[model samples]
Target: MISDSMAEVLRLLQLDDGFDAAAEVAVRAAETLGVDGLTVSLATGGEQAELVWCTDEAAGQFEDLQFTLGEGPGPDAVRAGAMVLVPDLAQVRAGRWPALTTESGALAVCAVFCFPMAIGAIRVGVLTVVRRTVGPLTDAQIGDAQVLAHALTGRALGATVLDQDKAPLLHAVVHQATGMVSVQLDLPLPQALLRLRAHAYSSGRPLLDISRDVVARRLRLDLNGNGDGNPLPVSDKD
Candidate 1:
């Protein structure tokens, strides 16, 4: 018997001929799961994951936070190629994702469930669902999410090839800024990205905002110590 949620997913797949069919289905799945919102990210070359779509601001913010901190259920699901369901972020050990735990508290996010879109050993992407309330998903909700994840894997494979240009690459600016930081500091891309994260976290600013400043040349990061002993100094370009 086709579950109501799965039935809706199939109906959307068949009827929605829009460019972002996968996103539409994902949003419906989020509704069925009773989550506040969700985001979909496709793994790019190497360790990068591009944010392709998000249902709401909170979802997008959480995704960006994970991207900046390099921790959280989304990243863990991608790395482990398995689902990482967090009933309550408060219950998570401090060491599990120390920075993410501390930072995410500021957002209206208390629960996150990450479903990795994978087939066999090949990982396609991840679907991250977030909620304002704290609790595990009901068994039926979990099943519906699994159905969505499986469907997304196939959809993502085709979308990655055909809709590559149309899909929003939200993190493209971050990568561009990372490269600029790498050149400015004479550091590798990884280290440059770390510096960007550190500066953002220390300033209590969004990572994307910091990256935008770097790309615009409005903010120059120097080795001079800020009052907080942070080596990255935020200064306007002369």
Candidate 2:
């Protein structure tokens, strides 16, 4: 039986019936779950999940950081096919998410909860909730979030089949930049992507910014570890 909170969220989702319904539901779900904000990301393939919708800037930043670093409650929940409830980021042990932990210290986030949207063997994506106040979710909130996650899985699948192009591709440029980097460095795609991520982490910049620079031909990574560990700025002139 769907709880009142879950029912309300589902009703909001039904009102849209378009590709953008996911965004509406995300905002409603965050309110229902009593969190500060939330984000929904759907798995594209091979450990890559693209952010489709987020309730606020903090939630979006948290999700983007996870994608850039490839480690965090969202990825862990997706990998394990279970929920990762971190009531307080400060309580987490060091090295759990080393780069994320260090980088996110300045953010206003204090708690994070991740729920995997999956059905048996098929995994769809993740629903991540964030709160500025450090505390575990209420039992009711957890139950409603799980229900919303399941509903979102079906919505995501339908969106893929109905209007795949209309679905937001927040990280499309990043993937294109990765491919370009791979060819430039004569490295495999995975290695090239890692180099981009490494530079983003070390330079304390968003992955999207670094990728934009690469795709725009304003930055080029080399094989001498300069691009990986210390990226050099390139002039816009050819």
TM-score of each: 0.63, 0.64
lDDT of 2 at 116: 94
Shift of residue 52 alpha carbon in model 2, Å: 0.9
Q: Which digits, one per residue and each the tens of the lDDT, describe model 1 over residues 1-238?
A: 3378777775676565542646777677678889999898887755678887788898889998997788889888988889999999999976999999888889999899999986444577888999999999988888778767766665654432222322222567777887898799776554566677668767877778888888989898875643233646677675
What TM-score does model 1 achieve against the real structure?
A: 0.63
Best by TM-score: 2
User: What local lDDT score does residue 21 receive in model 2, on the 0 to 100 scale?
Assistant: 49
Please list all clashing residue pairs in model 2, or write none if there are none: none
Runs of candidate 2 exceeding 4 Å displacement? 159-238
lDDT of each: 0.76, 0.78
- Cand. 2 TM to true fold: 0.64
